[model samples]
Target: MNEQEKLLNARDRFIDSMAKNMSLYGITHSVGRLYGLLYFNEKPMTLDEMKDELGMSKTSMSTAVRQLQELNMVEKVWKKGERKDLYQAADDWYDSFTALFTTSWRTGISLNMSTINRSLKELHNLRDNPETPDEVRASVKLDIEKYQYALDYYDWLNRFVDSLESKEIFNYIPKKE
Candidate 1:
């Protein structure tokens, strides 16, 4: 193959790989493919342009773009004198990773911590109640301990998320130059 053809082939392979691998983040392969296209494009593309290039429906293109935006993977851009909205992929992998992971992790941690707090509250009450059976009180105390440990872990996870968002994690694990 000619040099141009070889380069195109490599691009196709990487784009396809991106489409498949993005499933790890729960994105549909089609949407992942759309991200890959935007990442490889030289300039921001309009929704109509993306629809034509990907042979996707206008609705699908819109949904894909919205999903990428939510994940901080793609952003809309303003083009001078342009009527349609333009979007381009976020090029900084570190920022993208930080946004994606911190957002999801914080959400999950918040939910779990809330649940653990409620459960611990009830367990503590049960354990402290004089009327409670000795056996049940022991069980409640053990459950409280378990929940407290989980809460501690979630607290640590929150700190980890903070480090990632603040780029302080790089102090311990430096990025490649």
Candidate 2:
């Protein structure tokens, strides 16, 4: 194959690799592929352009663009007097990265706290039961202490994240006394 053809092949494989990696994180492969194409292209593309370039169905392209939009990974640009919405990757890819990070962390924190609370409540009930054996109650009390420690750790993590200034985090350097 000619040098140009080899380069194009390599580029396509890289884009596909990105899609696969994104899919591993539970994002749709098509959305990642679309983002790859937009990130590489010099100019914003309309849906038809993207479909033609990716050789995917127009419906797939439409859905991928919408999904990327929802993820804050892409934006619609207006062309003067043009009715079709032109799609472009976000100006700073970090915007997309931060959005994904914050959303996932928020959900994880909530779910973890909920589960810990439920476990602690059940353990508390087990310990408080009048007919419970002494040994069983002691075991339940130990489990409750472990759960409380876990909840305390999670709360510390939540506070740390909440105190961060998202935009400035990357450039921040700690002051030395």
Which has the greatest lDDT?
1
Write down the lDDT that model 1 would get: 0.89
Writing each residue's lDDT as its tens digit, candidate 1 over 94-156 gives: 887677777778888999999999998888888888999999998998898899899999999
What's the distance in Å from true for residue 86, model 1?
Answer: 1.6
How many clashes in each structure? 0, 0
> Which runs of model 1 end up more than 4 angstroms from their true locations?
1-13, 16-21
lDDT of 2 by residue, 1-177 (tens): 999899889888998998887775567787788889998888899999999887999999998888788778889998898888899999766668656555666678899999999988888888889989999998998888888898898888676555442555554643333
lDDT scores in order: 0.89, 0.80
For model 1 the TM-score comes to 0.83
